[model samples]
Target chain A: MTATLLEPTADPVAAVRRARRGPRRRYLAVLGGLIVLATAAFAVNVLLGDYTYTVPDFFRILFGEQLPVATYLLMESKLPRAVLGILVGLCFGIGGAVFQTTLRNPLASPDVVGVTWGASTAAVVAVITFGLRGTAVSLAAIGGAVAVALLIRSVGGNVGSHRIVLVGVAMTAALASFIEYLLSRASIWDVQVALQWLAGSLHASDWPTVRAVALSAAILLPLLAVLSRSLRVTQLGDDLATGLGARRFAPDGMLLIAVLLVAVAVAASGPIAFVAFMAGPTARALNGGRPTLLGAGLVGVVLVLSADFVGHYLIGDITVPVGVLTGACGAPFMLWLLARGTSSRSSS
Target chain B: MSVSTSARLVAADVTIGYGERVVVEALDLAVPDGAVTVIVGANACGKSTLLRGMARLLRPQSGAVLLDGVAVHTRSTRDVARTLGLLPQQPITPEGITVVDLVGRGRHPHQGLLGRWTSADERAVTDALVVTGTLDLADRAVDELSGGQRQRVWIAMALAQDTDLLLLDEPTTYLDVAHQVEMLDLLADLNRNRGTTIVMVLHELNLAARYADHLVAMKAGRVVAEGAPHTVVTEEIVRDVFGLDNRVITDPVSGTPLVLPAGRHHRPSLLAGKSPTPEYEGAEYL
Candidate 1:
C-alpha cells in the first residue's frame, strides 16, 4: 500500500499538466472552426444577394474598384448590416456570459437581469415621451441601463443566485409595464416610432450605427477579456473567491461593464430578445460545459447574423423586423427553460 | 516550506458576533505555536464563530485577534490571506471547474494583477494536490467527485494557499467514519511535519480527544474548559457541555481521553429497574 501511494506521488504533476494541455488545444480548435464558419457565412451574405453581385465582384468592390449598382449594394447596404449583426452578436454573447457566470445562475442574462429592459425602456421613453432622436436616444439608453443596474444592486438586498434573478425579474417586469404605459399615452406618430423600436431591427443600420457598435465593442470587449480570469474566480462564490485573494469590487465592476456592453448593443439595434439569453448557454453546450466567453460571442454573432439574414430575405417584400423574429423564436425557448427548471426542481 | 516554530497567536479579550447578539464575549485566549488545537462544542456555541473571528472573516466587536503581537484586522486582506488560510464549510464549487484550476486559485494571494501563473504557483498547486493524494483526480470536475474526494480537494485548495496558519470549520461533516479519521490523520501529519498552526471545530468529542494536542470545550458562547485532551476531557465537563451521560475512557492508540456514552444497553442492571435509561441517544449526536 505504501509503495502504491508512493507511485502516485512520483507522477503527481503530470496529470494536471496533461489536463491543461488538452483543454487549451480543444478551445483553440473550437475557436478556429467558429472563425472559419463565421467568415464564410459573412462572405456568402455579402456576395450572394437579390442585386446580383458575384463573389469576385464583391471582393473587387471591397478593394475600392468601381463596378455596377450591385457593387454599391454590396459595399453600402449589406456590408454594414452584416458587420453590425456580427458586432451586436458579439456584445450580446460576451455580456450574457458575464452576467450568467457572475450571478451563478443559468437564467441570469442581460434580458432577464433588466439591462436590456432598461435600455429599451429608455429608448422608448426618449422617442415617445421626450421626442428625442439619433445619438440622444443612445445616450439616454446608456444612462438608463447604468441607473437601473445601480438601483437593482442597491435595493436588491443580499447577493445570491436566487435573489439576483428574482430581483432582476421584478425590475424587468416593472420597467416593461412603465414602457407600455408611456406608449399608451403617446401621440400616434411618436407611438409609431416607439413601436418600431419595440420591435428591434437593424433596418436603420448605416455607417453611423456600425461605427457606434464598433467603438463600443472596441472599448468593452478587451476590457472584458482582461477581466475574464477574475470573473472565473468570482463564480466560485464570494467566500471562496475572497479566500483565494480575489477582490470583492473587481468582479462586480466587470459585471457593470458587461451590462454597459449589452446596453450599447440594445441602443444600436433595439433589445433583440433572447440573443443575449441564448448565446452563452448555447456556446457552453457546444463546448462541453466549459464557459467560453469568446466562443459564446462567436455563437451570438452567428445566431444574430443568420436570424437577420433570414428575416430580411426569406419573406421578400414584407421586411419583417429581426427583433420580431427573435421574439417569436425566443418566447417558446423561455417557456421551455421555465418548464425545465420546474421539472428539475421537482425531481431534485 | 518550513514555517517558524514559535509563531504564536494571541487574542486579547476578543468579542465577536453578528449585529446585536454577541456570540463570543471579551475573552482572552492564546493558541500556542505549532500545535493542533481542536475546538469542540454544541451548535451555536461560537466555535466556528471564533475561528472566523481569528481568520478576520468576521470583525471583532470589542477586542482584537493578533498574530505575532500584531492586530490581524490592521493588515491588508492579501497579507492576512497569505499567512492565514481558512476552509469554510459548505463552500460552493463553480460548475465544471477542475481540481487543478480550483487548487490554482489558492495561489491568488501571492499573485498580483499583472502576475500570471509562475513556477512557484505551479509548484505550490502540484505539491498541494500531491500531499492531499488528489493528484490523480486533478483533471476531474469537482462536482463529479465522491464526498470524501471532494472534501480532500477542498483541503488541497487550502493547502495550496501555503499558509502557516490554517483554520477549518467542521472539515469532516459529510464523511464516513473511516474518511473522518483519515482526514484528521492527514491534518495531524501536516501539523507535525510543517509545524503549521491548525485550529479546527470538530463535533465528535471522541475524535477531538484522539486527534487534538490542545482541546477547547465551549458551551453557550463561552469557553468552559481548555487544555491538553487528557486534562480537559472529563465526565463532569462532558455532562455539563453536551448534557449527555457519557463515561470517559482512555483511547488505546492515542493515549488520550475518549467519551463513551452510556446508552440503554450500557446502563447498569441495578439502575435499569428503578428508572429506564433513554433509548435514543439525544439530539446532541444528531
Candidate 2:
C-alpha cells in the first residue's frame, strides 16, 4: 500500500474510481438484495394464506381473469393489504431515515419522536368524538402530525437537535394521555374502529386506504428525490455544509418532507408501531453502517409485509395486529440502543 | 504590498456579532492577494469572528465583506464558494467516511444538482489527497487516523474545493508543537507554489510570525497592528494585543520576529552571563 501511494498512479482518476468501486458495489448489492426480499415478502403476504395460490394464478387474477374462490378474496383483501403494506413501509422507512439523519440522532425516528403519536391522537379524536370515517380520519391524522411538528419546533426553540427530540418525547407522553381519555369515553362500536388508531392494523386495509397512501407517495417521492442530495451535505454539520454551498433551508426542507411522509403513512396504516423507527437503523446496518434512504424504504416494505404475514398466518388461531408485533419487539430494541449510546459516550 | 491595489477580500467597516452582543465593532481589513495573512489575538478578541464575517458565515450588521468589489452575502452561495473555501475551527467527520469521500464532497459547488461523478471530480480529489500527503490514507476511515493526520485530511478536503482563497480557523489548535509547525509549513508551501491566498486564525504567535507574509495583531475587536512580521511584532504591540510584557528578537531559523515573554520573576538579567548578547539588547521596545 505504501509503495503504491509513493509511486503516483498513471491515471489518478482511474485509481480513485477503482478505490471507490468496492463500497459502491457493496451498497448497490445490498439495495438489490433488499428489493428482492421486499418482492418476496409482498408475494407471501398476498398469496400464502390458508388458501394458497401459485404465482401464475396471482398474475392471472391481476390481469382480470377470475379464479373460482380466489378472485374476490385476493382482489378485495389480500391485494390491497399487501399494497398498503408496501406503501406505508416505504413512507415510514424513508421518513424515519430522513428524520434520523437530519437530527443526527438514531433516536429521532418519527414514531419515537411523537409524529406517529400525533397522527394517532388526531385519528382517535376524529373517530370517537366527531364520529368521522374513512378519508376524514386520514385528514385528521395528517393535520395532527403537522400541528405537533410545529409545536415541537416552537417549544424546542431552535437551540439544539436534542431539545426538539426531548420536546417531542414530552409531547408524545401528553398526547398518549389525551388519546387514552378519548378511548375511555368511546362507545364499544366506536372503540373497535378506534383500536385501529391505538394499535395499528392492516385488517382495515381497503382500496381507498391503498389509493390515499399511493397518492401521498406520488407527491412525496419526487420531493424526496430532489431533497436527498442535500442530505449528503447536511450530514457534515451546519458550518461545513454552508461552506460547501448547501442551501441554508435544506435541512428544514428535509424535515418537512419527513413529517409529511410519516403523516401519510400513519393515515393509511394507522401508525403501525416501530416500522418508522426500525427500518432506517436496520437498513443503515445492512449498508455497512452508512445511511441509505432508499434501502431503508425498501426494508420497511419487507418488515411491515413480513410482520403482517406472521401475525395473520404464522401465529396460531388468533390473528394479531401488526402494530402489537412490532411494538413488542421495537420497544426493547430502542431501550438497548439508548443504553448502548449512553455507555459508549461515557466510556469514550 | 499595496493593500488597496491588490486586495481581493476587503472587510469595510464590518460590525458583526451574534444576537445583540457585538463582538467585532467597525473592523476594516484588506487581505492582500496571493499572500499568507495570519490573525492573532487574545481570547474573545474577535479574530475568529472576523474570519467568519469574511468567509460569509456571519453577516456584518451595517458594513460589507467584499470579494472582487462585490458584497459576498449578496452573491449566490455557490458563486462565492467557487472563489473561496473555509475550514471551520471544528468540522465534523461523518461516521465511517473514507478520506477520499470526505475530500470529494469539496467538489459540491462545482457540480449541478444531478451531476455525475465526472473524471474531473476524481482528479480534484486525487490531487487534494496527494497535495496533503494523504494519498496513502485515502481508503482509511477518518476517525481512525491520528489527530495530525485527521487535520491534514480535512485540509485536503478544503484543498479539493480548488478555491484561490482559503480561510482556516485555528488550524493548529489541538496539535503538538511538531505537528503545528508541520501544518503551517504545508500551508506555506501552498501559498508559495499555488499562490493560493491564505488567511488563518493562529494561536501560536511564533508560528504565526514565521508563516504569515502579512501579520495582523488585533485587540478589543480591532486591528492594533498589521504588516510584515518584522514590522508588526514589536514589543509594544505584543503588550497591547496580548497583555504580555515581551521582548521581540529575530527568529534564528526563519529570520522573522520572535517574542520571548518576560515575567516579574524571569528577567533578562538572568541570561546576562549565560549566552551571547541578545539581538534586541539595546533596541527600543517599539
Best by TM-score, which number? 2
The TM-score values for the models, in the order shown, are: 0.92, 0.94
Worst 10 residues of 1 chain A by lDDT: A1-10
Model no. 1, DockQ: 0.41
Tens-digit lDDT track for model 2 on A133-246? 988898999999999988887787652368988988999999999988888888999998888887878888899878878988899888888878877767777777878888
Q: Worst ten-residue run, lDDT, model 2 chain A?
A: A1-10
Candidate 1, position B259, lDDT: 87
Chain A agreement with the truth for model 1, given as TM-score: 0.91
- Which candidate number maximizes lDDT? 2
- Give the alpha carbon lDDT tens digit for every residue of B138-177 in model 1: 7887878888888988898899899988989899998999
Model 2 / residue B7 / CA error / Å = 1.7
Q: Report the lDDT tens digits of candidate 1 across residue range A169-192.
A: 899999989988998899998988
By summed lDDT, which 10 consecutive residues of candidate 1 chain B come out lowest? B1-10
User: In candidate 1, which residue ranges exceed 4 Å CA deviation?
Assistant: A1-10, A335-348, B1-8, B263-286
DockQ, every prediction: 0.41, 0.36
Residue pairs clashing, model 2: none
